[model samples]
Target: MAKRRKMNYASPSTNKIPVIFSIAVILIGLLVVMSSLKKFTHTPDQGAIEENVQMKNEEFINRLVPVAKELHQAHGILPSIIIGQAILESDWGSSELSAKYNNLFGIKSFSPNDDSIKLKTKEFKDGKWIEINANFKVYASWEDCMRDHTLLFVNGVDWDPYLYQGVLLASDYKTAANALQAAGYATDPDYASKIISVIEKNELYQYDK
Candidate 1:
């Protein structure tokens, strides 16, 4: 007679442990991969971002071309210089002064008879930026605002070169930008550079022709 050997089997729960652990590990790895992909898609490339801004600025400049040409005809100031100044001072005609008062040049009000609006503004003084409440001249139309800006450069009805000689005598956009700084057009020390940057970046000199 042969003795039968006793048979033993492992419990089902213990058998399933390896399978459950592998499933859990795979789920965790999938989650990590998904998270990485999400970040990559959301991140913006610097070059693309800058290109978008340039496109927007170009669109804004194109929209104002007609007015710039009109100003060029009325006054000898280069359309490029005027448009660059407008973009710098008024933020592409989107500033509070431009939006509400049509004040594109940030010119202070000296004429009491002219319609005006009071607004908070920053001025560079004593080598510091100072907040001040200023009265800015308001124009009934954008053309009027552009005309006023031209008058500031030429001054009086005579078209005398003596008043704003630095501006009127400028031979080109670059010279005009530099002249504006020399003539104290803005309080900022880098005002000319800022305007020049805008003009060059957009190739505004083409408008001078």
Candidate 2:
């Protein structure tokens, strides 16, 4: 092969056996690194606590979501409006009546001629809950109240959306809330403020966006 090329080679400090040992050492190091990462990431208690909080929030959201979604579907009103209304009316489930009666909106109805149905209600007279017999429309369930709310918007002859759209075209949440109040949605002077409070406090508007 013409003057054959000379090849020179030198053995490392260790032979193939040492190479095997080095490979084993590398594998062990890699395993240790992986294990450390696993340990760092394994926060079972934290995960469980976070999950519980999420579940509670989900339950609260579920309780309020139907009202918001219903109004959104029927009137194109932001679900936030409904959520806010519930909060203001129900006091975030802290109201004594809300806990017992589930009447979040405090809607009223009584036979004009007869005092057949009377219910206990709270009034802010001198800042106290007064057990007075008030005329209120009782429902079979809370769901009925939300349904009725939507229907009022659609069925009210003079105050229906068809009639009021032009009036509320520039409607912000505050304007719409005030418009509803002016249309006799509620008697309370602070009605709109209450709805706005609930929506903002719970961040209920997130449901829409």
Candidate 3:
């Protein structure tokens, strides 16, 4: 009976091998796609982070420019120095002391009756740094804080009314920065240099005009 056609049927296991191979290939492709997506969605690069920081700094400077100019016109405090100190002391008004209490200049309050808050701060002393708790002035707004800061230079300490007169007399940022350091506005020995660097780097002198 015409020799029964030799039948060669594939085994279930053999069929499963191709299916498994296809599934594995598909899984590999999916893995590759997921990896690519992860890379695409990764966090911002260092350059992006720096750009963001620069933008924020610019915003801080811009926000202070008008007020600083006004104060400069009225008080003779150089806008460059005012803006630079704010940048350095307040960290562009991002510091907890400045942001929360509007104490942009780190102005301390010596009297118990003053509107103030006690906070820990670092002071440069004996050629080193020390942490100390101090009372810092509190203000109702940034503008008010700025006005108070100007007033400090204008009014000076009770013991020395002309302590910061050198700053007001300064014709340039460098002189004003040095005057601030000479007047002991900050305990940091490098305070003047730091302020000058900030002013120059940001072209804060332009605001002085």
Off by over 4 Å in 3: 1-30, 39-42
- Among these predictions, the greatest TM-score belongs to 3
lDDT measured at residue 153 in model 2 versus the true structure, 0 to 100? 58
Better candidate number, 1 or 3, judged by lDDT:
3
Full candidate order by lDDT, most accurate first: 3, 1, 2
> Which candidate leads the pack in lDDT?
3
Off by over 4 Å in 2: 1-58, 94-96, 112-117, 122-132, 157-171
Global lDDT of model 1: 0.84
The TM-score measured for candidate 1 stands at: 0.71
Backbone clashes in model 1, listed as residue pairs: none
Q: Summarize candidate 2's per-residue lDDT along 21-95 as a digit string, tens digits.
A: 989999999999999899779667988998987776567568779766766766766667666776677666566
Task: Please give each candidate's TM-score.
Answer: 0.71, 0.55, 0.84
Comparing 1 and 3 by TM-score, which wins? Answer: 3
Report the C-alpha displacement of residue 201, candidate 2, in angstroms. 2.2
Pairs in steric clash, model 2: none
Local distance difference test values of all predictions, in order: 0.84, 0.65, 0.93
